[model samples]
Target chain A: MKYYIGVDGGGSNLRVALVDETMHLLREVVRGKANPNTLGIQQASDRIQQALREITEGFHEPIRAVGIGISGAPKAIAEKWLRDTVKAVLPFAEVVPSSDEEIALVGANGERRGVLVLSGTGSIAHGANDAGESLTIGGWGYLMGDKGSGYWLGMQALEAYIRHEDGTDTRPTSLVERVRQQCGFKDRFDIIPWLYQPAPDSSKVARLAPLVLEEAQAGDAHARHIVEEGAAELALLAQTIVRRLHITQPRYAFAGSLLTHPTPLAEALCRRLRLPAPPQPRYTPLIGAALLARLTVDPV
Target chain B: MKYYIGVDGGGSNLRVALVDETMHLLREVVRGKANPNTLGIQQASDRIQQALREITEGFHEPIRAVGIGISGAPKAIAEKWLRDTVKAVLPFAEVVPSSDEEIALVGANGERRGVLVLSGTGSIAHGANDAGESLTIGGWGYLMGDKGSGYWLGMQALEAYIRHEDGTDTRPTSLVERVRQQCGFKDRFDIIPWLYQPAPDSSKVARLAPLVLEEAQAGDAHARHIVEEGAAELALLAQTIVRRLHITQPRYAFAGSLLTHPTPLAEALCRRLRLPAPPQPRYTPLIGAALLARLTVDPV
Candidate 1:
């Protein structure tokens, strides 16, 4: 019997799974901060090897292949770390390492042609064709271009408070109360000194999306407007990626935790695409890696 | 006949006007950055003296009442600064100093019982009844609260770009191009380093209100929504202040360069207030200050 391993490394957490030739998730393990830049190559490799050994200790069969999908892992340093670390741990296994986004797309729809829209700590759209060609639209990170993502919304709320507080822009949003509370802030003036303190985690921003969506759902005009606009933008990104990958009427599967929530965004995507939005995929994109391990595609 | 001087000291510019007893402006002088905090008290004081000297340099007559409206002058420090700063320069002039917003309100209306909404590099709403009692709504400053102001709008645009670029928030706003051009920022990642730098003026944020309003005017949807919200918020503030000031049917006077643009905020305020939108006053708020300076009123 053959065995396989799949790993999905993201901004906040890392997920790993072991499966037999049949793509079922036999066992899994989770860890914190697996980004090579964050944990350093050797340490990240050690963590991965330790986790994998703990999960698949007594499987008598040789490992077929191991696939890793990691955020911020495209850097040569990251890739090398993955290769060296995995090689040292599971010396007998073939490892196919890729971006966390890439595996998310595969897991979202399971080898079917589709677009994957992801929004959590950050936002990006990735799609793959029947042929391996893929493309992306916006995934610039919080500083430049992750519109409608978690970080964007949080920062946006801060902006509104500042404008209102500063006597320049006056837009009342129900999210203000939550925003101020979450930031441990009382008013806009505190933001200058506070934001200057340190580089906060990218995922911290997404926390506001749910509150904004709930307010929108509850008939807060500002929240509703924000969701509608955010949806339109997510749709634009999905559509752009679809066009880029020559995916006509592709089945898109959303793979982010944000997608699981009933945001106007996914609903808007369905409306924009004129296709029924699939219920959140039954499994996570990490499973896509397991499925990859279970595949019979001839590697010619 | 007696004469007096009124000065509007803002972050970027200063306007000093000399007026005769009937509140007629004789002449004026303009300069820069007289906010004691931004430009130190010495530097700002020098500019203030320069402005007063330029406006009444050759008059050779003592001004009966000199009312200088300075921006960023908190009440606690207003007295000491007024005693030392203004009096130091114009020994022959009686210096009566108040906040820039208060002076702007008096400037916007020749002599009226109502609310004055000032939106410039910052925003604040202050209202006074016939009894001389007053109340304030917004105008916390760039760090805490300044709703319906320019700085808030600019901050919104910058955050939108960051969200979009990072792929966290998926909303697409016209802010993409506007922020790029305004900040000359190349992309989302480019902002990471710049965000760590030191910036004192919140006026930079206020600068984006017009740009936001313009985009809304062009129907970018999100931009328009923000403008509408901004307008509505401004109206709410006006109404709040009006209620607090106990003026039932007061004329709503608005000042600030933002009013010069085609902002729906005024209309929104009209809608929110359920009152016909008043015209931009016959004279700017600075002129109103000139009127107050020329005529002395001591609740007789």
Candidate 2:
């Protein structure tokens, strides 16, 4: 039986899985940060090897092909290292390394025509046409940009806290203390380090956005304002990507850390963009990569 | 000779003077931080006594009355305590002890009619009616509210630095690096202890606003934005004070830490107010207090 391998490398963790050509999950494995910036090429490659080995321990089935996806492999050097590394170790196979974004796009489209609005550690909106063109917006990072991401929303909440703390604020903002306690921050003293620290994962604090949103849902004006702003930006990104792909009437799907709940942010994105109820992806990005591997290898 | 004393007690230094009823300075003495919040009220009172003793040592003129300007001596209890303390030491005198704000107004107006804006270590705008009724706005405190104050502007600049340290930013934030270096923080590790260490004097950092304005005038957008925002707020405060006093045609003056030159915040304040000419105070707050001393003993 022909076997296929699929990899999804995230900012903080890596998830890999092996599947038969018929699409049954054979085995699964997990590892630490596999993004090249954090782990570098050598370490990422070593982790990949261990993941593949652990997943295929007992079986002697020859690996047919491998597909790997990364959160941000923006440069050519990163792609070259990934493709070469898999080829160097496997000895038996065809290897493909793509932006985790690319695999997510394919997964959302089901190899056809749909857009994927991603709001995870970062935020992005990308679409694939029958002719394969791409467009994006609002993924410029945290500063001088990034309007829709969790970090962007969190930063705004922090600004409100700061304004209130400094006394120039006419606006009543107990939200600062509310969020402070929620995030385990004792005072403004805790904020300076969080703002400057280069944590092992830049998205570590982003995980706190949902709690802030829940606060907003419970009628906190500041928290609600933050979520509303985030959603509006994400919606704009989706609209821009859809227009750029030239899909006059486009249907798209969204996935990522933001999809964990039917978040107010997600709800706002749909409402703002006027997007109808879109399908939510049932299978994980790894499952999508495995499906892609089966297609890329072709058939008899 | 009927001698009158005018004393300005500060956290850093105290300046006391023996002047004639005409408000001309005859003798002067200086001591250190008598505001007990910084040096304890007892030491502050002792410093006051020392400054008085040195100035009055060679005086044969009967000291008729004394006026002292002190921070933290708000309306009733604090004011009564300060007046009692000074009276106990120099019993043969009519003593008038009040807030630095009230004395600043009296000095700026020279025992006549006008408005005084105080922007010192903290910021507040206050005025007195011809009826002796007084009102104040802003200058709540460093933590509660002091919009357009030196400390407010300084905290705003710090927020900009925090943004730069987070890699999510793209703007040219070289100013943040320069400011951070001043505190000996190479990274976030040392920044923690340094930020939270005993009695963090956030005001020192605020003293950087004028420097920031200089940088802004030299084409730094961030600095310019900070100063401009502060200027706008100060102007608004001036307008608010005017509105409150129902002064249709008002003659106004300013005091405090932000009056320093070679910066845009003050310039912006003047420009936004559409002042056709520069308004420089003819006398300092001490002189203003002396005028108040003369008025308190005014034989109306």
Candidate 3:
């Protein structure tokens, strides 16, 4: 009997799983951030090794392969370094490494023949054609791009709040009060110190996306406009991928909190894309990593 | 003859000038950044005092009055602290402090009666009516507003560059190459580290604004679009001020590099606002600070 190990190394946290050849998750261990970009290579390697050792120590069976889906590890050098590091830990097993987004696409559809739009802290659209050729759009991070992302929504909300506070925006919005209540800010100037002092956190700002959605549901025109625009931006991302890949009636899998929420952002996105129905994700990206590991040793 | 010290305390640098009642700059000294928001109140005060002492060392005349225009001194507390600090340094001088925008308006129009649109690292529209009542429209800093400012333009250019880099945008732009050359960055991922590592500097990012202008002048459709959008946003700022203040075809004064540049951004702004002519600046903000000091002693 053979087992496999799969690791999901992301910006926020890391997850490692022990799985059987059938791609069933047997035991999983979660750790803090293990992205080599944020955490140094040594730290990331140590965390992955620790997870692998802990998960396999209880089970004496030799693992067939180890697969890792790391955020920001798509480049050749990054992949080589990561593969070498993972190989060092599980010397007997085959180590395969890929980008977090690629694994997400595989996880969403069980096969690489659909589009996956991940809209968590940042946003990206990933698609794979029937021939297994893959492409990505709009995962450029927060500084340059991340349209329709959590950070984008938060920024739009902040802009609306500031404009309203200034009494310059003729367009009415309840965002000032909503944001003030949400952020626990008593004065408008408080936002200035809050945003700049701590060196803006992407996740911290992304947390405000739900506030915008909530306000939109409550009938705030500005909030609704932001949601619509965010949906449109995200729809454009999906549309671009679909058109570029020449996929006919591609099935779209929704990922991240923006789509999973009770808000209309996802509905608006699907409507903008003119999809016939909502597509459900087949599995989580972690399970997708496990599936990829299964395919490494036992390709059918 | 009595001398007045005029201080223009900005985010990037500070300028101090010893002037007579005629508002002619005598000995002038430039120092490092002195915005109380960026530099603490103590450090900002020390820099301002150092510049004042350096400029007035050779001439031993008692300064009758001193005027200061600080970037973030509009708040009552900021103004009071600055005034107290200035008074402590110049015991015999009557100290007056105002927002940087107010002094810019006074400096550009030669009086406090017209609108001044400043589009530097940040942007704002400030105006003083005939009743000496002042109102401001869009000085909400970089995070919330400053639509047509250098920082805004630079961010737009970066967004365009990222979109083009991702192949998500069909519109061709030289921004990717132009920005790479300007920033001396060989890899695309370098921008992420450069931006978030040291806490993003608004001015450093703003330095890229000229590249967008250069690209636009060279006829890049994407760059041109960004410039046009920026111009329209700025025109809205000006229009808001005009309607709120009930100014009839108000003579508009332009301050800062966005408008001062040879690009069509300013012309576009003016055209959008339906302005017939560009209002010439009567004096620099330093002289405007001096004139404001003159007013402190001899208010009409």
TM-scores of chain B, in order: 0.85, 0.89, 0.90
lDDT of 3 at A191: 80
Selected candidate, larger DockQ, 1 vs 3 = 3
Which scores higher on DockQ, 2 or 3? 3
Using lDDT as the yardstick, the better of models 2 and 3 is 3
Please, what is the whole-model Cα lDDT of each candidate in the order they appear?
0.68, 0.67, 0.79
Query: Residue B170 in candidate 1 has what lDDT?
Result: 63
Best by DockQ: 3
Please list the residue runs of candidate 3 whose C-alpha ends up more than 4 Å from where it truly belongs after superposition: A75-77, B58-61, B184-188
How accurate locally is residue B140 in candidate 2, as Cα lDDT from 0 to 100?
Answer: 53
Interface RMSD for all numbered candidates:
6.7, 9.5, 2.1
Q: Candidate 3 has which clashing residue pairs, if any?
A: none
Candidate 3, residues A84-135: lDDT per residue as tens digits?
8777778888887867877777778887678888888899898888766778
Model 1 lDDT, residue A274, Cα: 78
How far is each candidate from the true structure, as Cα RMSD in Å?
A: 7.5, 9.6, 2.3
Q: Residue-wise lDDT of candidate 3 within B3-38, one digit each (tens)?
A: 788888854679888888777677888888887776
Question: Candidate 1 residues A1-300, lDDT tens each?
Answer: 567888888766788888776577788899887776667766777777888888778867777888787776762336666766677878888877667776777676766357888877677877778787776556666644366687776666666655455444456677777667767886444665466435444555567677777777777777777767776777878877776677766778775666756666567657776767645674577787666555523142
True contacts kept of each: 0.04, 0.00, 0.54
Judge candidate 2 at residue A157 and give its lDDT.
68
Q: Distance (Å) between predicted and true CA of B49, model 3?
A: 2.1
